[model samples]
Target: MKAKLGMSPIAWWNDDLVELSDDVSLEECLRQSRSAGFTGMEMGRRFPSDPEVMLPILKEADVTLCGGWFSGTLVNEELAANKDRIEPMIELFRAVGAPCIVYGEVGRSIQGDRSAPLAQKARLDDDEMKAYARKLTEFGEWCAERGMPLSYHHHMAAVVETEDELDAFMNHSGAGIPLLLDVGHLVFGGGDAMRAIDKYHARINHVHVKDLRLDVINGLDRTKQSFLDAVALGAFTVPGDGSLDFEPLVKRLAEHGYEGWFVVEAEQDPKANPPLKMAEVGYKELMRIMTAAGYTVETQGFPRG
Candidate 1:
């Protein structure tokens, strides 16, 4: 199988926690990520929506627009409203030739609110999940028909936060709603990443290879601290520099014939853990794991000698 290496722009500049960001231009961000051996990058706030304006900057760095996040409100809103909101992003992703748009449910999410405790994350009973799943399926189908797919991201402080929530969502949702398997978030949310891979492998269309600092995760008082607080305490990191063992996960993914972009998406303070350096660590580790898993890593003019 073939796999591509991508990096998220959050490492350089966070959208939710602006204070954790590095003051850098979009060009510099792409250049640094490319220097770290990534051939693709997810869109960030600094990125211009106009493909005419964005494509050249990406081409200059020899980087592909792999994927990007979209804060969705499908949990409480109607499908029509969600459609209206996603239209522009769908057009942008289609123009950019991105694989998928990472759709994270933020209708009842407290991820951005540092004041809200982690335990206060939104919850959905089975009946509520059933309705939300139906809406998500319709939305995902709509996005896919438009030539841009939607990969549902089960986030840290969203409605579908824990393993049980994910199971509920997946059990109710159809094949139309594809999954974005964020290993770090799954692990941090007290979910078994391996079990999730085993169960949801067929639905997983994209991957986020974010590593976590277990010490920080364990130390966090979920009742008092919020998701952003945990982030501020250094709960996430790049692979090979943190607690995750990607070899098994990559091997499992390869075993299931999973192929596509494996993105490095650890969100941390750029000043404390420098995006470029952390990206390098993530890229190298993914390279090793992908090789061991018999994956041919795609090179979009990267690792140049």
Candidate 2:
């Protein structure tokens, strides 16, 4: 999988440096990404929510927009108001010329507490999975008309999180719809993150290269803390800084012939320290992993010492 590495600029924000208001140095972020040798980037939501402002920046940076993310809450309900929900996002992606949108399926969860005395979360059976797939397939077809792919992102709060749920989601979600797999989230959600990579490698459209700290996850209060809280607590970090085996991960991707972007997204505060240092750590480790797996960064012809 000779993929380009891209970074998200959320790490570039400094709460104190700027009120995080009128302007953000999007150009500085592009410089950082180019400096890091990435060929593409996942534009930050704050960078430019409107295409008019963002298009020029992306063109100037010479980086491709490796799809943006749109999150919604749906897991326990059938996708109602589906068109109303996704249409704007479809238009947004089309307006910006992004080839795809890394998306997650979420709905309200059925807390046994919906009545309260018992409250154990229920599961989605195969029938529901198929229905969900049909709905997703419809969306994919719609996006296809516009040359945009809605790559289903399997997130923690999603019905497609656990292994069984993952199986069901795959079983039902339309085939040929590209999947934007996130390694860290899969591991956090207690799924064998690499198994699917090897099994359904052909459906992969893009990837979010997030790494996890199993220890942090293992310590969570399984009942109260929301998935977002866990992420906020540093459960995720850039690859190589955590406990994940990239050799097999990459091998499986290569075996499947994946040619997409591995966008490195670490939801940590860079200001607590320095963004570049962590980025350096991330870039070096990413290169090491790629090199070990025999995938080079298509080096810019200045031979080495």
Candidate 3:
């Protein structure tokens, strides 16, 4: 299968935690990412909303726009209101030829709250999940009809966090709502990436190749520490620097015939773990695993799914 390697700008310039970000321009971020051998990058806070203005900067760096995060509120807000909020992103993604928009359900999310402990994360029972999933399916279908699809991101402190929650969400949702499997977040939340991949392979439209510092995660006091606190304590890292053995996961993806962008999205203090160094580590490790898994890694540009 054909796979493309991409990098998220979070590693260079974090949006949620600006303190963790490196002092760099968008051009420099793209330059460093391309230097590390990534052919594509996800949109970040620094990226211009206008595609006409953005395309030249990306072109100069020899990278394509892969995918980016969208803070979605479909769970708590009306469809019309959500539609209005997402219209600009939909137009931007469509204009840039991005594969899919990463829809992170941040309606009731505590991920950005530095004081909110991990234990206080939002939750929804079966009935609530059913309604939320239905709404997501409808929203996903609407986005697809407008020329892009939503890849639902099951995030760290979001509503659909653990394996059970993800299962419940997927069970209730239709094919219209595709999935974005973020392995690090899944594993950090006590979910097995291997098991998730086995079950949700068909629905997974995008992949985040995030790796974790298991020691940090294991040591964190979830009852006292928030998601951002865990991040500050160095909970996440690039592939080879972390505890995950990505070879097995990549092999599993290859077995499932997965073909899409595998974006390296390790957001940490750039001063501590320099973005360029970490990006190279992630790129090399993914390359080795992708080759081992029989994937032809695309170098020139990303393929539109």
For lDDT, the strongest prediction is 3
Candidate that beats the other on TM-score, 2 or 3, i.e. the better one: 3
On the 0 to 100 scale, the lDDT of residue 56 in model 2 is 75
Segments of candidate 3 deviating more than 4 angstroms: 302-305
- Per-residue lDDT of model 1, residues 62-148, tens digit only: 899999998899888888888998899999888878999999888999999999999988788879999999889988998899999
Assess each prediction's global lDDT (C-alpha) against the native.
0.91, 0.67, 0.93
Q: Report clash pairs, candidate 2.
A: 73-106, 73-107, 74-106, 74-107, 75-106, 75-107, 112-119, 113-116
lDDT (Cα, 0-100) at 53 in candidate 2: 70
For model 2, the superposed segments whose C-alpha errors exceed 4 Å read: 12-24, 72-80, 109-122, 298-305
- Deviation in angstroms for 227 in model 1? 0.1
TM-score of 1: 0.98
Candidate 2 lDDT over residue span 1-305, tens digit each? 46677776655652222322223367877767667676666756556766677777777777667777655444444445655676776777677667688766646442112131111334567777787766777666766776678788876655677766777777776664678888887887778868878766778888888888788888877666656556556676777787787668876787677776777877665555245665677778888877777675653211122
Greater-lDDT candidate between 1 and 2: 1
Ranking by TM-score: 3, 1, 2
Candidate 2 backbone overlaps, count: 8
